[model samples]
Target: MNKAPLITKMLPRKNSLRNGGELDTKQLLAALMAFRRGDFSARLPEDWTGVAGKIADTFNDVIRTNQRMTQELGRIVRVVGKEGRITQRAALSDVSESWGDAIGCINVLIEDLLRPTSEMARVIGAVAKGNLSETMASEIEGQPLKGEFLRTAKTVN
Candidate 1:
C-alpha cells in the first residue's frame, strides 16, 4: 500500500485566505501538526500580535506544562522504583484552567496511592514484631478508608 506524506496530509486545500483580516494560520497549523506527531517542543510564534499572539502563547504554555508533567512523572517513577518513596511533586504554573485541574488531580492521586502503602507498611512492621492486633485506624474524621486498604486492614487485624 502507498501513503501520502505526513506534511501533505496537514496542508490546507488552498494556500490563501479569502478574508483580508484572517490571521496567517500557517504557524499555528504547523505547531499543531508537529504536536500531533508527538513533538511536545512544537510551539507557535509568540511574535504574532493581538489574538493570534495570545492564542500562540496559550498553546505554548500548554505544551510546556505537559512536557513538565511528563518529566515529573518520569522522575516520580524513578524515585518510587528506586527509593520506594514519592519524594518529589509536579508543579505546574500559569496553566489553563483545565490543566490546573488535571495537575491537582494527579497530585491527589499520587498522595492517595502513597497513603495506603505507608499505612500498610506500618501495620506490617507491627505484625512482624508479633503484634497482630495493630490495624489501620479509620482516624480521618469524616473520611474512613475504603477499597484495598480497608480490606488489608481487616485481614491484618
Candidate 2:
C-alpha cells in the first residue's frame, strides 16, 4: 500500500506530458489549498510539509501584526484636532495607510512563502503556456488568490 509510487505511476498513464513534463496549475492549486487547510495531512509530501509549516508560522505572525495595526489605527481614530473637531481626514488617512501596510506585509510574507518553491512557478508557467485545458483552468480559477494571481499574470503577458 505504498501509495506514492502507485500515484506516480498512475499520473503518467493519465497525462504523460502534462503531468510529468509540466504540472497543471489546477493540480498545484488544489495541492496548495489542501496543504493550507490541513486537508492533506495524511498524505503530505515531505518537502511540502516542511515548507507549509513555515508558511503557516509566517502567516500567523502576519495576522498578529495586522491586529496590532488595527488597534493602533482605532486609537488614532478617537483623537480630536483643534477647535474640538475630530481629525477625520488625518485619521482616515492614517487608518488607510495602516491597512495598506498590513497588506504590504502580507504580500511580502506571500513572496517569502513562495520563493522557495520552484515547483509552484513551474506549474503556473505551464498554465500560462496554455498547456492546461478549460476545465483545469476553471478549477484553478476557483481557488482563492490563485485566480487573481493568474489573471494578473495573464494581463502582464
Candidate 3:
C-alpha cells in the first residue's frame, strides 16, 4: 500500500542521517554564530558531497589555521613575557603574508628587548675586568637608550 511507503519513510534511514552535524541552513547559521562569538570549535559538516561540502572544507581549514596561529602566539607570549624567557620565538610552520610578518615582528621585538641587556652586561663585565675602554654603546640595535638606561650608560662610559 502507498501508506506503507509513508510509514517506511518515517523509519530512520540506515546510517544516512548525520545526527546533529548535518550541513543544513540551521547548522551553517549556528556555525557562523559560534565563530562570530570567537568559538572556532563549531565546524560545518564536510562529509556531505557537493559545493556545500567544498565550502565547508575551506571554512574549516581557515578556522583550523586561525586556531593554530592563535594558540601558537599565545604560547609564545606566555613563554616570553610571563616566563621571562626572551629567547623564546614563535615557530610558525606556515609563515605567509601577514602571518609571517607578525611572527617576525614578535621575534624581532624579543631580540630588541634582549639586545640592550646583553650589551649592558658585556660592557659592565668588561669594565669589571678593569677594561674602562669598553663602554656601553650609545645605542643598541639603532635605538638609543632612554631614561634610566641612558643615565647608566653615560655613568658607565
Model 3 alpha-carbon drift over 4 Å, by segment:
1-23, 123-134, 146-157
Model 1 lDDT per residue over 4-115, tens place: 7876775444543333223467767888989888799898876765656667788998788778878876777677656776756556766668877777887777787777
Residue pairs with clashing backbones, model 3: none
Across 1-157, the per-residue lDDT of candidate 3 in tens digits comes to 3699888776435423344333466677888898888798979886855555766888887788778888988998799889988778987786599888888988887887778778888988998898989988878868888887788778878
Q: Which stretches of candidate 1 lie over 4 Å from their true place?
A: 1-24, 46-54, 138-141
Best by TM-score: 1
Using lDDT as the yardstick, the better of models 1 and 2 is: 1
Candidate 2 structure quality by residue, lDDT tens digits, 22-126: 334355566557646644331222233343444444544444444555554455345422332232222223345657666566445444334323334565677
**Pairs of colliding residues, candidate 2:** none
Q: Rank the candidates by TM-score, best first.
A: 1, 3, 2
Best by lDDT: 3
Model 2 C-alpha lDDT versus the unseen true structure: 0.44
Q: Between 1 and 3, whose lDDT is larger?
A: 3
**Cα error, candidate 1, residue 149 (Å):** 2.0
Q: Candidate 2 regions off by >4 Å?
A: 1-49, 81-157
State the lDDT at 43 in candidate 2.
29
**Model 1 weakest lDDT span, ten residues long:** 13-22
Arranged by lDDT with the best first, the candidates are 3, 1, 2
